[model samples]
Structures are given as C-alpha cells and as structure tokens.
Target: MKQNIYHQFITKKSSGKKSFAVLIDPDKVNAKSIAELVKLSIEAKVDYFFVGGSLVISHHLDECIQQIKAACSIPIILFPGSPSQVSKYADALLYLSLISGRNPELLIGQHVISAPFVKKSGLEIMPTGYMVIDGGAPTTVSYISNASPIPADKSEIAMCTAMAGEMLGMKLIYMDAGSGARRPITEHMIEKVAQHIDVPLIIGGGIVDPEKAYLNCKAGADIIVVGNAIEKDFSLISEISAAIHSVANVNAG
Candidate 1:
C-alpha cells in the first residue's frame, strides 16, 4: 500500500519544508489541458494536485483525475466542493467542513450525505476545516455555501476560528480567498491564524504571482495553493512553486 499523503504533509511541516499545491478545477480544464498541466506540474515539482471546484456542472471530474494521474506521478488530492465530487481514483479526499460558516448544510449536512460513499471509495480522508476570507468579491464557494466570508481585516476572528478547528481535531485548516480572488489571504491573517493552529495551514486564491506566493509562505502558510494563476501562465507553476518552497518556515521550530 502507498504511504498516507496526510502523514507526509505533517512530516514536511515538522521538518520546515513548505509545500505547494496546484488546484485544478475539473469544470474549467478539459482532459487535453489537464494532460499539459500534468506535464508542467511534474516539471514544477508541486507537492500535490488539488482536484475539484465549487460547482461542477459537467461529467469531467473522474475523467480529469484519471488523466492527471496517468500523466503525473505526484499524489492527486480531491478538493471537492460537494459530495458528488468524490472519486476513488484520487489518492486522498479532503473531507471538508465549513467551520467558518454558520450554515448547517456546509458545516455538517453535506457530510452526512457523502459519508457512506466516501467510506466505500476507500480513499484516504483528511478532515479539513474550510474557512473563506473575503477576497474582495463574491466567490462561487461563498455563494454556493450561502455563508458570508469572514472579513479579511478581522484577524482576531480568523485566529479564533482556526484555533477552534485545531481543537476540533481537524487535520488541516484551509483558508481560501476564493478562485480568481482580487486579493489573496493577507499576511496578517495567515500570521494570526497560523500562530493559533497546530495543523498545517493551506492558503489559496488570488495568488497570481511568485512574490505573493513567497510572502504567504514567509507569513507562515505551510502550503500555498495556486489555480487561476497557473491557468493564465503554465510556466508560473514552476516559478511559484520554487518561490513558495524556498521560503524558510520561521515558525516550524
């Protein structure tokens, strides 16, 4: 059997080796594009490929995962937006709970519907506390969940929420600014939240450039996720990966 990828992430965090994940929304990219992305991803040396989207109106999810797996050796983790997004082919699934939201549906309701299928799929499940920070616009996730994002400037709220997630035993805490966000998760928010949580912190959305990716790592994000950025410029996968992984995790010790 293959080693659990979640354990690998924990080990990487403990060793102060930051990681990068390329989010591939199945709804946005086709099989041919995914093949190209996988090749670029291999050259970039990304730690993980996050597969899923906020709303998948097509039947491409399973096909996309299979194609990426065939072309890339790296582990593909399912970052699903809903229960239907689960796939057995992926190495792991981020069993997410919208801990930052007040909506009962996203917090636990959906889990009840998806639990049976997830267990049957035999995919490694990593429970994640998903938090949405305002990225200066309305995002698909925010709209779909019907939950307001925590204000970006309210670092205290982010800190409290993250600490609660850690206490709840969530394996990871994901703070996203939403895909195509106008702004990425701020350094202050990342710093405040990371200080309060023990699990690996994953930040995503609006990370369009290498400099922003580097700053997020320096601010204490253990993993940085870039999606739309890579879609705009395939070469950025390597640039952003290097920029993020190169930063020293000052908080690791």
Candidate 2:
C-alpha cells in the first residue's frame, strides 16, 4: 500500500511547497500513451497523477492505474467523474463534492451510492470541495454536473465558497476552469480562495504553459493540475513540473 497521500498534501502545504499533478483521462490515453506519460512523469519528478475525466466512457480506469504503477511509484489519485470510476489500484481517491453548484446529485447523491464500494476498496479517500469557475467558455464539467460556474471575476464568491468547504471539513479545495477552457482561473481568484482556506488548494484546467503554472503557484495554489494541455503535448510534463518546483525552491532561498 502507498503511504498516506493526504498527509503528504498537508505536509507540502504546511511546508510552503508546491506540487504539479498530471491529469489523465482514462478514455483519452491508451497503453502506449500511458507508457509515454509515465516515462515523462518519472523524468520530470512529478508529484502526483490525477487519473479521471468529467465523462470517462471507457473501461481503462483500472488498466491505466496498473500501467502507471508498473512504471513508477508516483502516487495515483482517482479524480473520478462518477461512482463507477473507482479502482483499488490507486493510492487515493479525491471524493469530490461540487460545492460551487446547487446540484444535489453531485453534492451528495453520488457519494451515498459509492460509499460502500469506496470504503471496501482500501483507497485513501480524500473528501474535496470541488468548485468550477468560468473559464471564458462552456465546459463538459459544467454541462455534465448541471451546475453553472462562479463567474471568473467573482473573487469574493470564490473566497466564501472555499471557506464554507473548509468549515464543512473538506480535506482540500479544488477550483477548476474545466477541460479545454478558453482561459485559466485568474491569479486574483486563486489568491482570494487560498487566503480564505486552511486546507490545501488545488488549481486545475486551462493551464497550458509553464508561466501559467508558475503564476498559479505564486498565487498560492498548493497543487497545480494539468490535463488536456499535457495530453496534447506530453513534453509539457517536464516544463510544468520544473515551473512548479521552482516556486518551492525560490521560497526556500
């Protein structure tokens, strides 16, 4: 079994360290691509691998986990879109609640149905408050979750929402712009949410470049997650990883 993954997050947050995670949608990558990604992730010294998508219509979830496990020891965290996405092969599962949306199903309905299986799977369950922010375009996450994102410019709303999630005992708070977003979440919004929450803040979606990753880290994101961009250009793993780790290095100096 993998070491406690949530504790790792807490430790990194407390120590002022930043992490980079590669998000792999099971339906998007095959064995060959997974092998390539795992190789790049190992070389880049990536901190984590977030495995899942908004709509995973494939049966490759377990296979994907196994492939990554076969090549490297980097922790695999299941960022599942639904109850059916769980796998015992992962080191942890981000049991997400869509706090930005009013949809009852995503907020709690799915959790109830997946509880027993998740409990039995032995995967470290990290309850997370997941918020979707407007990224200048409609996204699959917003459409599938049936929830409207908090407007991109609403920093106050994002701050309050993160505070509520922390108050409710969420282990982490994740604000995403959704896959293939036209714009990334603003640094101001990230700073606002980070200032308001005590738990680790995870920022994802539309981060396509090393500069954006670096800026997000400087804005107080504890973990920067990149998916579609990395899928399009696997070489980004090294560049973004370097950018995120550089923040910690600078802080240490």
- Candidate with top lDDT is 2
Q: What is the TM-score of each candidate against the true structure?
A: 0.96, 0.98
What RMSD does each model have against the real structure? 1.9, 1.3
Candidate 1 deviant stretches above 4 angstroms: 1-3, 249-253
Itemize residue pairs with steric clashes in candidate 1. Answer: none
Q: Which clashing pairs does model 2 show? A: none
lDDT (CA) per prediction: 0.90, 0.94
Estimate the lDDT of model 2. 0.94
| lDDT, residue 100, model 1 | 91
Q: Work out how many backbone clashes candidate 1 has.
A: 0
lDDT of 2 by residue, 1-253 (tens): 3349888999999999999999999999999999999999999999999999888998878998998999999999999889999999999999999999999999999999989999999999999999999999999989998899999999999999999999999989999999999999999999998988889999998999999999999999999999999989999999999999999889999
Instruction: Indicate the worst ten consecutive residues by lDDT in candidate 1.
Output: 244-253
lDDT of 1 by residue, 26-114 (tens): 87898678888988888888889999999888887888888887786899999999999988889999999999999999989999988
